[model samples]
Target: MPATSTNTCRNNAVTKVLELEGLTKSYGAVQALRGVSLHANEGEVLAICGDNGAGKSTLIKVISGAHAQTSGTLRLNGREVRWSSPHDALVHGVATIYQDLALAPQLSVWQNVFVGAEIRKTLFPGFSILDKKRMRAGAAEYLARLNQNIDDVERPVADFSGGQRQAIAIARALLWNASIVIMDEPTAALGVKETAKVLALIRHLKDTGVTVLLISHNMDDVVQVADRVVILKAGRVAAQGALEGISPATLAQTVMTGEWPQVQ
Candidate 1:
């Protein structure tokens, strides 16, 4: 049987990668999130689900360092942490891939992958140029690690499919050596095959010991990939548990009604 939601470091096999306690956020009079607490073990695919206005987006923003929480704490690998910015979060091994995937449509795949942290080739002292060759090879290597094949890393992102774009974004995260990846609606609006491709990429991340915080409304995708799920409602955690025996329909209903299905 799969394990339920619990803090790790109890066993070598279950070291936790992230933890939250009394996490709260507000926009002056608007409480976007309440004392939301959760933990994710290393390599675990933890699905975060909630209806519109359930604080899923706000919670992600806080976790990804886009916004600071009003109160409470965040811990990575059992060490308390506070993020100053999204780049700060990325530097600390947390990377967020939003619904847009944040790719430069006009840029080539390698360019998109190494957007912020570009490799530099020094021709002389105190001066360097973009190391296109190294970055291109590295980008291809990362995508290959995800089992995605792109014939040309120089091709503009605008020419690729939605799923392939996702791969490129993930490869960017890989470039950062991210330990935790937050994916927002990764398979949204994708064709079945494309969705499968994205899901496979997610699975590959998990298999490689990367903790994933997956925000998705598709219960089928959640059930197929998530080991555990947290359902939020009205800025608080409504229900949470392992997905061991639950069906996607039941999970969907739980998300809507804020109640876990009762055991017979």
Candidate 2:
């Protein structure tokens, strides 16, 4: 059965925030993804793990509106719709934080947080001014809420560490009221302490009732922060289940060999 056919592994009581059924994507002669399906519950951390060529990036692109699926159905909050672009997905409350982060290096923290979606106040008809004061304050509040160590919101993001930059990106997503946050390789290239901080931030998002879709190769991080996991092999789901019942070794084995072993 397809992964989306049944929400058996999911908590039936909670509503599914995002659902993809038989999602397939192809690039000319190259078929990047097959008939992949999955669902993410509201306020839960769902991890997607796979080997190097398992089409993980293609799947993420499909869901984030970076690429349209060749054949499949994507349902958001039980409604069927197609997003034209990443901005459309963001408008629908689906925010993706890619590895590059897309932050303007020279811009201040507050500026980066509210880059395209700037807050504004209208003083006259057809005229509005950017609410710099409110944006700065809001940015500071969001960062503080996440318990990040960035003391100054007016400083350029280029001056911050990798983990601090990740925290800011997350804050921007939450500031936009994103119901579902998709993070791709959030811990990549970071030191041990930095990775821990990002993991804690993910936990914080879950605690605040935000659904998170985490894509990472770090089995230890997945085991530590993910509530559930879906392993992909050759562009299809190989195994999926709650992390509490599966060990990190089992997850690693499933990714490497495309087999789900008995947990005992």
Q: How do the predictions measure up, each by TM-score?
A: 0.94, 0.92
Off by over 4 Å in 2: 1-12, 123-127
- Per-residue lDDT for 218 in model 1? 94
Off by over 4 Å in 1: 1-12
- Residues 1-264, candidate 1: write the lDDT tens digits: 111111122345788789999999999999989899999989889999999999999999999999999999999989999999999999888999999887889999999988888889999999999999998988888888888899799999999999999999998888888889999999997999999999998888887788899999999999999999999999999999999999999999999998988999
Quick one: best TM-score, which candidate?
Answer: 1
Model 2, global lDDT: 0.86
Error of 1 at 232 (Å): 0.1
List model 2 lDDT by residue over 1-264, tens digit each: 101110122344798889999988889988888899999998899999999989888888888889999999999989987889988887777889999998999999999988777889999999999999988888888788789757789999999999999999988887667878899999998999999999999988887778899999999999999999888888898888888877788789888987777756
Model 1 global lDDT (CA atoms, 0 to 1) = 0.90
